[model samples]
Target: MTDATLDRIAGALAGMVLGDALGVPGELWPREKVRSRFGRIEEFLDGPADNIVACYFKAGHYTDDSAQAFVVLEALLKAGTVPPAKTLADDLLEWVRSMNGFEINLLGPSSKASLLAWSKGEDAEAVTKLSLTNGAAMRIAPVGCLVEANEHEKLAETVARVSRVTHSTDVAISGAAMVAQAVASAVAGRSWDEIRTDIAAIHPIALVKGEPTWAASVLARLEAFEAMVEKLGDAPSEEDVSLLIYRAIGTGTMTSESVAAALAVALWCRDPWLAAVMCANMGGDTDTMGAMACAICGAKCGISGMDESVVKYLETTNGIDFRALAKRILEARANFTIGD
Candidate 1:
């Protein structure tokens, strides 16, 4: 693979970890609380002792978002593409098993529920029947980088195949597909307008009986992002931006909200570290939003744009070699060619 392509992949992965760690301490806090506690999260801070979920981890530690994405990365490296649903399901189940006693795992509701069903020997389809959460979109960075540019079908199918193992509902799958496509576009150096167009083109598919879809919600978030950005201007205060995102757009773990929040942050920050900082301070589901936004910005800017010390610190602390992961993904990328 070309060095440029590899750099983009590495940047995307490293950005994910950095964002996750940076946001760990601030997860779930409301904008008001976040502002009062830190003013603005300009650096990594340990999870506060009083916060229930945050206390499970320390500063500079990533939550299940990056951990699960790492699992997905390993699976993609082994399978060289989107693995079979059963195979992916097994892999995810094993991840839950490995984290059996570790409360820090912090698996999201959707993934936790689906894995619990799998552990009970339920069929995969049944396990995924009620999973309309952001869990699917949070861990789909590998698929984004591996999908060749302009290959929307490959992107969508790959996202669906992986997402269905944990999140089969229309909103989850659609959000995941949009994220993967946006990452692909970022890897190809597409403009924000092009990426936005790609995201807006996604169609939600209802796969299960009685499960509601978020097609309208997803579209509305997209428009909300555009409107918010137009009004916020290029240099809104961090407080103003955080409050707007939390109250106006919502920052919870829901796919319709968090994924769109990530996109909005990416468009506004346009830089990996800046995006990470902003999303970290925005509060609810901070790590996932930060990782998602930073991944996209990293794709646009490449790893060289990051601080060398911070990257090195993340690699040393997290025990993840993003460069090696990028290399493996590049190998997998070569095995599957997308047709124009």
Candidate 2:
């Protein structure tokens, strides 16, 4: 891979970690409470009395979003390609069972369900089919980056395989596939809109209205973001800016809404640090949204594009080494080519 490509990958990875960390502080707050307490949501608020943020602050780590994403990254780093369904399933089960130290910081419902099924002696594949949650989509960004675009079938199959190990609903699989395809398309220099459209075409049954319903919602919020950026300029108070964007875009159950909110922050904030901060402050499902935003913005800006503070936090706190991971992913991709 070229230095430029490697740099972009590093940026994306860093962005993901930054988003995860920033969002950890505000995982599940009601929209009104988030707005009232934080008064504009910037730079990880304290908590919503009792929410994921409080747990995260006490533990100093994230939930299943970051853990599972790391697992996906580790799997690719070890195998140099997407592992088979059984392999992925086994690893997931093992990870859940043997989780120790800081690893137990985050455990989502879908993962919990899978672990329960495994403990009960159900086949991993069968257990996964029973899930309809967003677990699969939450950790799929890495898959999109590793596979080649031409290998669409392989991509879909791999997504289905990995998702079925824990998430069985078609929505879960489709959401995961959408995220994977989005990351792949971004790495290949395609427009986000184009990528969304293509994924919709590929999985008409999985997506609502054959397009991500949230993209439009996100697009609508972009105008508001632009307005805020204009009014506040570069040094806008983080709290005020966060609330402005959050209220306009929303923080809710819809995956598109959450994803779009994060993307809007990235689009409005020229600085990667600001983008990550804004995303985390949005409160509801903050980590996932922040992670998604970071991935998209990181792809656009590169590692050099992020602020030193954001980079330092990710490196020291999260223990993420983007450059190394990027090299490993590239090498794995090359090996995949050779094997083919």
Against the unseen true structure, what C-alpha lDDT does each candidate score?
Answer: 0.78, 0.62
Residue-level lDDT of model 2, residues 1-340, one tens digit each, is 3776677677777777667666765577765665576665455444344664346352224455767777877876787666765666667766666664225444665567676666566765555555555567667777766776546666766676566667765555665665566566656666656655545443533333122222333333445566666787767676676677567666553444564465556555544567766766566777777776677667656777777675776576556677888878766765652132
Tens-digit lDDT track for model 1 on 1-340?
3788888888998888888889888788887798798887888889888777777777777777888888877887777666777777788778777767234546887788777767677875664656667898899877889888677767777777778878887778777777777777888878888877877765343122114654346557868867875697877775677677778788898888898788778877788899899888887989999888888888878888789899888888888787888888777886864233
Q: Which stretches of candidate 2 lie over 4 Å from their true place?
A: 44-49, 52-54, 58-62, 97-105, 124-127, 191-275, 337-340
Question: Which residue pairs show collisions in model 1?
Answer: none
Candidate that would win on TM-score: 1
Q: Residue 335 of model 1: what lDDT?
A: 81
Clash tally for model 1 = 0
The TM-scores of all predictions, comma-separated, are 0.91, 0.75
lDDT leader: 1
Q: Write down the worst ten-residue block by lDDT for model 1.
A: 202-211
Give the root-mean-square deviation of each candidate in angstroms. 2.9, 5.5
